[model samples]
Target: MYRDNLYRMEVPSTMPAHAFAPRNLNWNVEQGEAQDLAHGLEKSEAQALVFVSHARPDDERTKALFGFLRRASEVADVMIEKKQQSSWDAIIEALTPTLPLTSSRVLEAKMLAQAMTKVIESEDFARAADIAEIGHFSSKNPSSQPNRWKNSGLIFAIPYKGVDLYPLYALELQNGAKPLPIMEKILGVLQEKDDWQKAFWFASPNSYLKSKAPKDLLKSKPQDVLRAAETEAAGVQHG
Candidate 1:
């Protein structure tokens, strides 16, 4: 009975640090910083947002692959969310007369992708192979809002190597890198054969194999170039 009582007394000592409230810790640490921020605003002090990060300094391979991509995506997502939550009146007030809207949207998407890639491949992120995507996106018949604003991003179940890279590489090789679009048959013919277009599918291996295609055309982004031969063929035939 004495030993049992002693064991019970020791149990609480081994409790994990996380058993305490998380918010309290954050509140204590962040309090000074928040106060400084307010003081800076009052003084109209020059300031730059130093990116405090959770990622470690040593992460390399994962950073290269997913660091920039993840971070950029996160940052962009926050901005997008804020914009979405804004009232229409507030949005109208914030709009710039010289907005090159499409370009901005594209930039945001690119940044998000870059951040993600860095995060995934950075050496500090040691679990390079184990790293999995949390979210993702696809652009088949993408709406302007979702494409520009970005819907939820892709969530990879596994690190992209054997399973993901192989198929992508195989597709690249089969397509002769001209991407998935083989326009030779279609420049004019695709416009004529609307029904024939249905037969072509980018996901089909048979549709992609070819040689002597433009390097630029072959490797053009995946979402695009997926059905170039088919779409153009329909365009020409349908037109």
Candidate 2:
């Protein structure tokens, strides 16, 4: 009973002066200095790390804590509820842009976007709707067929301006508009890579193929294209 009582007793709120005072003082001073350095707006660039001292108990408590933070600083609040299932949801919610982008960064982005738009909107790339209309895919949801093909790795799509556009060369126009015969093998070589990387490999000139872009020879010389993809994949692995 005595041992059980001792086990249940609360820890002392204070420690001996010699045991932790020096360490506590040092830690407190360092933490204060870090906060001062991070939050000093007079610096050319400053960033701060803020956190709640304890786990919030409820939605109202969470909201109240964030509200206090917003009042204290120029912060954009993202109130996460207990019921949310994914960590990504909270992160995405926190990152959702609350203001329009401005300055030279915005100008550079706009220029890049215009250049990409010119290429992505060309005849080389077409949306699912266009392919469905031209290829006559036998499905109720014609627009979804290309996405299904992309998911299966029979073909890939590039994302531009919030829309996915498929390369027209990925399909065979002569034979029931099925996926290009060699694409599966090429995609296999570049497996686990993102769409943009795969797209870049197709668009960029390859020295292995005598400086010809892979897409240009995909129909005329599929075996050569496959070799080029293999060589690129090998280089990426080794280099």
Candidate 3:
């Protein structure tokens, strides 16, 4: 009797010998004789059906297959993350059906909604309560301080999910939680832009700053970040 490695069981002594033969060797054998052997040695059809129905995958085999699938899934996730924009585009393209002008506009709206959700849920930004905690606003109205900061042009916020979401990195934690000094200057450069636009500008990569987002370099390279913002404002004025 031969053991079937996949299902990890004896394949029944009645199974034809050619069933265990290597594919290449089996191919060279006489077809008629192989058929005769199969007809003579094969088990009853009921028994064969019972064997198939009762077969269970071995535990080790299942684990190995699961491990292989998990590793493949992880690799796919990393690739998708590395090429996020392209991956998103591909997914949208795949999902978007053939449509007229109105339907196409609806798809555009959906894409915009997805973009907004991503920005709102980003770890870089936080709600007023969280910002208050981080900035150490130990008052009854914890949100008021952040709002005051926003009103003063010292920082900007994005309104999402019925609340204002402030950029966490824009606060200088070491300086008594003061808004970063460069914020006002940057906001001055972006004065014409509304809160949402200003928030987008800070998060978007700038060519003048070697493609680093303005918020990322707020502390490490304030001057460069300011220059980038100025360059952007200049282009807008001219354009």
Candidate 4:
């Protein structure tokens, strides 16, 4: 009886046009629940189907997700191809001698400078009032006025483009516009280097300070940061 009924049933393609027409499907899938089971194959498929039913072609979130997935797939392909062809150690051994130490340092410096430029452009720097803004001129004389702040070592200026930007982190404002005790010590250690180099020293992550940048640790652990700066200075001096 079941086989006879099945034989009598009409095929989907042969059904009425309205019956075969695509129907709007809606699924009330919660984002948090879907995310929780995102890694599970069955749950992932269910989530995908839900998205497919609701997601429009022009959806920005869907576009970004697909774009990211595409890039990730491309990177995976490149990595897999490289792994199959040659090991990283073998490749490094082949290319290492061709690249000189000076060349490597120059490349590293260029990359670091580019990274620093991004940070500076993003306005992530601490607010430090300039000489004119601070209004602390020693005399009416223009020449001597600029020298007052420069000579005191109270502020270190980083030269970006044509302007000099001073980081305010070196100052202890709570103690009445005075320089932090360790600031002078750090400045002394980094005195021989240029302004940008000094900025990099303070801003770059320090291995001695457990990967925290010196500028960040200056307030909490100034002595330890200063010690690290001194060690770096010693290396620079000896090297």
CA lDDT of each candidate?
0.32, 0.66, 0.67, 0.59
lDDT of 1 at 154: 17
lDDT of 1 by residue, 192-220 (tens): 43211222222223334342222234355
lDDT of 1 at 110: 95
Candidate 2 residue pairs in backbone clash: none
Candidate 4 residues 1-239, lDDT tens each?
11110001111233235432333323222322233334443433232322221355455776676556445544553565556456655776888777456988999989987977865874534433444335453334433433455577755776666656666666655544445678777887788988778877777789999998888888899999989988998898899
TM-score, prediction 3:
0.54
Candidate 2 deviant stretches above 4 angstroms: 1-118
Distance from true location, Cα of 201 in model 1, Å: 2.3
Better of 1 and 4 by lDDT: 4
Ranking by TM-score: 3, 2, 4, 1
Higher-TM-score candidate of 2 and 4: 2
Model 1 Cα shift for residue 62 (angstroms): 74
Give the C-alpha miss distance for residue 213 in model 3, angstroms.
1.2
Q: Cα miss at 31, model 2 (Å)? A: 51
Using alpha carbons, what is the TM-score of model 4?
A: 0.45
Candidate 2 lDDT score relative to the true structure: 0.66
User: Which stretches in model 1 have alpha-carbon errors above 4 Å?
Assistant: 1-146, 149-200, 211-232, 235-239
Instruction: List runs of model 4 lying over 4 Å from the truth.
Output: 1-113, 122-147, 174-176
TM-score of each: 0.14, 0.52, 0.54, 0.45
Cα lDDT tens digits for candidate 3, 1-239: 32322211112324345332222211111112223334433553322211111123344554565456445544553564457667667888999997666888989889878767767766878877877776778668888988999999998888876888888888888745778889888888889888877777887878888888888899999988888888888888999
